[model samples]
Target: MSVIPAELDGAVIPGGCADCNAEQHFRQDEPGMWFIGIAHDDWCPTWRRIQAQRAGLPTTFLS
Candidate 1:
C-alpha cells in the first residue's frame, strides 16, 4: 500500500509507504505497459542496510 496519491506525474513517480514514511517509486514500465510496485531505491537507510546485508550472489558483475 502507499500513503500518497497514485496520480502523480514526473520523470519518476513519487510515493510513500503505507507502513512507514519512507519515499518510494510506485510505478514501472515494461514493453508496452505500466504497472505499480515498490521498485525504487528511495527506501530509508534502515531498509537499504537490511537489504544489503541479505544480498545473495551478484546477478551480474561487469567491468
Candidate 2:
C-alpha cells in the first residue's frame, strides 16, 4: 500500500519500493554497478525490509 510521492513519479529505480525516493546513479568511475542515494522516510517499512535483506537479516519480521 505504498505510493510513490508525486514529485518522484517516473524517477524511482525499477523494482524499488514505492515509498523509496532514493536516486539511482551510474558513475563512469564505477561502471557496471548502480548506486542508490537513499531518500526514503526513516519509518518506511519497505525501506526497512530492503535494508534487512541487504544486511542478510531475516525479513520475516517485516510485513
Candidate 3:
C-alpha cells in the first residue's frame, strides 16, 4: 500500500509478487516531479533488471 494520495497522477509497474506488487509512487514539489519509492519483491526478476539498468549494467530483458 502507498501513503500517497490516489488523486495524484502516477504509474504502476505490474508483476506477480504478492508482497511488493511492483508499484511506484510519484509526487511533484518545488524540486519538480520525483518518484517517492519503488515497491518490488527482493527476488523479482523485473526489479533486478530495473536495478541493473539504473546502474548502467546490461540486462537480458529487451525493451
Candidate 4:
C-alpha cells in the first residue's frame, strides 16, 4: 500500500520492491504499457504512518 495519497499530482509513478521505494517510469515502447522499476534511487515511501502514536503526512488532494 502507498503511504501518500494516490492523488499526488506532481509525484511520478513509483516502482521496485515495495520496501525499496525507488521511483521509476514506464517508457512508451515495444513492451506496451509495462513499467520498468528502478532501484537504489530517490524514492520516498517513508511518509507512511506505521502506527497510531506516530503521525503521517497530510493527504494531498489533486484537481
Among these predictions, the greatest TM-score belongs to 3
Residue 2 of model 3, lDDT score: 39
Q: Could you give candidate 4's per-residue lDDT for residues 11-63 as a string of tens digits?
A: 45656546666665444333233334354333435423233225544456323
Candidate 2: segments with Cα more than 4 A from true spot: 1-17, 20-38, 57-63
Weakest 10 consecutive residues of candidate 1 by summed lDDT: 4-13
**Candidate 1 runs further than 4 Å off:** 1-6, 9-21, 28-49, 56-63
Error at 6, model 4, angstroms? 19
lDDT of 2 at 3: 37
Alpha-carbon runs more than 4 Å astray in model 4: 1-11, 30-35, 42-63
Per-residue accuracy of model 2 over 29-59 as CA lDDT, tens digit each: 2333334454566677877977777988456
Q: Taking the tens digit of each residue's C-alpha lDDT, what string does model 1 give over 1-63?
A: 544444642234355444445444444343334454454345566557658867855646523
Ranking by lDDT: 3, 2, 1, 4
lDDT of all predictions: 0.49, 0.52, 0.62, 0.44
Let me know the TM-score candidate 2 reaches against the reference structure: 0.34
Worst 10 residues of 4 by lDDT: 44-53
TM-score for each predicted model, relative to the true structure: 0.26, 0.34, 0.38, 0.27
Candidate order by TM-score, decreasing, is 3, 2, 4, 1
Candidate 3, residues 20-43, lDDT tens digits: the string is 567665554524445566688788
| Model with the higher TM-score, candidate 1 or 3 | 3
Q: Ten-residue segment with the worst summed lDDT in candidate 3?
A: 25-34
lDDT of model 2 at position 23: 46
